[model samples]
Target: MNRRTYLYAISFAIFAGRFVHGAEPSSIRVLVWDEQQREQRQAYGDQFLGEAIASHLASLPGIVVKTATLTSPDHGLSDATLDATDVVVWWFVERVVSRVQQGRLALVTLHSAHWSKPFVRLMQERAKSDALQQIPEAERATARIEYLNDQPYGKVPKADAPLAPALTRTATGWSLVLPGCIFPAYRPDGALGHLTTLLVDHPIAKDLPKQWDIPQTEMYNEPFHVPTPDAVVFEERWDKGEHFRSGCVWKVGKGTVFYFRPGHETYPVFKQREPLRVIENAARWLGGEVRKNAP
Candidate 1:
């Protein structure tokens, strides 16, 4: 088998071992971890952003929700708590990467989390895997790989610069350029953004309108520097002609990583129906609840 197929087969084997033939968990355990910046008060008021999301999730049936902040004990992620969790809806957190890779839980990163450590690491891993997949099968076992450093944070790549997560064959093996996990440009002006569901039938797009708008949001222009996603569920555009792959999913090891890019602490974007629906759908799908309910 090709390297990519082999890796996926192994991931599936590990994932399949976790469940019985016809049994699935009755309730999905969701953990919402937020940095809880004071600036969120501008939009969420007394209830913090994380707490607001937790409250909304708690109102849904078959979902068990918990809120955690930077100040929470153990940062609200003690072993006991993680052991009980099935999905993490993260604003920013890094400790769960290993757990996600182990198929113990799944991760959903919100806007700006593209720079979070966990997301970066997972993207790097995916980049390495992609690089290895390009090697000939006979040389794969012995290929030597070197990962180059990431671009500086907030540094925009020149339009003519090489795209990252780039791979080059070497005399010995390969040199891989890790994803910078940032885009070429961003504007925090809270302008309106138009969104189109690129994968309407995707579980993460369930119940979402084919076309929607974020009344207020930061604009993230693309050529997003990351490994190509397994799926791009939503695309966002601005009147100025900038566009981005707003909702993307990647398979990392035995689990999943999803990034949704329509948020800013000072905007009430999450309060809208479509964004919340995206999060809810992602949680259900990531937590295995959607698959369990599938006919």
Candidate 2:
């Protein structure tokens, strides 16, 4: 064969190899959880959840999530289940899983924390302390409205507080929040870290809200212990709860977890722009790709 012909063939061969060796795309095994509580479902909206989330993630390429709720056998996260789970979006857990089991999980808490997990009440209480109380009155006003809106769920022993009058309008089943103050936390770090300092110009926070300026939603505030935060990606102000205040994930061991705090909007999580992006960003983050470009 002629030298030029051979060279051309070799170049073509190299291009083919490059195409073959390109990333196969990371696989994500997500376990969508639910505790099957009437109150929880009532709050989160059941009709549109599964397909909406599944289709959204599926469109991202190379990500797959298998859903299971609180009522599923073993809540659908069996030893076999864990073998595939890359990120677990915990819908709600009414009971605590063993530490060994918990270790395997990278959790995301949705809405009012539909299920009771360890330190739940404590987490809520801490978020409502003097620290969170100091947020602007407008923020407090919003939370009060959400609490009032949610009160129709059920009646628990009243805390007898400032937000009480709003509850008078509360209906019945079980409104998730109590008096609906800022979300309490078991925040070990204790404040919102500057996203600029924490993220170091990561893409994940590339398009994040400068101050989470979204409106008409609940607030998630600080006093959180983000495990190994290289960056503070998000801080939810005026959110109804604390879990979403510290929504992030750093490397724990070999695997990664994206701990999302929002998702309280009923029916579909995506209906809300903030929750949708958070969920999408989280899924992409776990995949080791550029969803945020959010430094």
Candidate 3:
């Protein structure tokens, strides 16, 4: 495993040490908000906002994770799923949020969830053409090669459209657009709070040192323009706005919502460390003590 990967494994072992001693484990039911971006289905896609978390939690006994999305019945968060869901991680910008504020459904938002280019690519591509032929053999092969090489949307300085060619080249692998176009790594506003980052004991960041592949990894590094006080739970010293908001836990009638503002389609934290910890904790927190569900 890579350095970041090894760190998380170590951190998980460290964190688990506590659970092994004093904590009584409870089952966590997690739901990620995934929307099918029909077009970008090529470049990069899916709505499993908390996938990294889901994977980690799934390994823990008692935790049950199910996926729900915007494309599913009732946007994938059906009544049954919602009722059973201890935590729901949402990141779709276009998704119509039900702020009904039920005592259930802990909602964790990632990347502030204000962008959904994968969704945009579908509308734009489909609105323009469907008689589309398969990607040219040369470009298709190259894009696939790029993806396999782990170079999809390589390093970009700044952007309104950073992922264009860097991504267009591999977009096909993500099944986004044909080849040649790039995806924007971050929007204008996204560059705001990203000028610096501080790391600490925040649960979400507890494993970052071990999970993030800094020099070799690709993160949107969007700057948080309107950062709120204490809203930042952890920060990256090198990257300006890379902050981890410890954890957001809210109580519902008998359920809960843990809206996390991490994860971005840009870097795709689907297999990152910090995100995994956030998810594991959120699942358990939302899932609550076993007694909460007892007779």
In candidate 1, which residue pairs clash?
Answer: none
lDDT at position 111, candidate 2? 43
What is the TM-score of candidate 2?
0.47
What C-alpha lDDT do the candidate models reach, one value each?
0.72, 0.37, 0.35
Model 1 lDDT per residue over 41-133, tens place: 898889767777778888898767666665788766665655455444332235566656666556677777676666778788888888888
Using TM-score as the yardstick, the better of models 1 and 3 is: 1
Model 1 alpha-carbon drift over 4 Å, by segment: 1-25, 87-95, 150-155, 289-295
TM values, all candidates: 0.86, 0.47, 0.44
Window of ten residues with lowest summed lDDT in model 2? 8-17
Best by lDDT: 1
- The alpha-carbon lDDT assigned to residue 119 of candidate 3 equals 20
lDDT of 3 by residue, 27-53 (tens): 344444444334222223552333444
Tens digits of per-residue lDDT, candidate 2, 98-184, equal: 221223333344444422232232233232333234445555555542332222222323323233212222343223233322223
Local error of candidate 1 at residue 180 (angstroms): 1.0
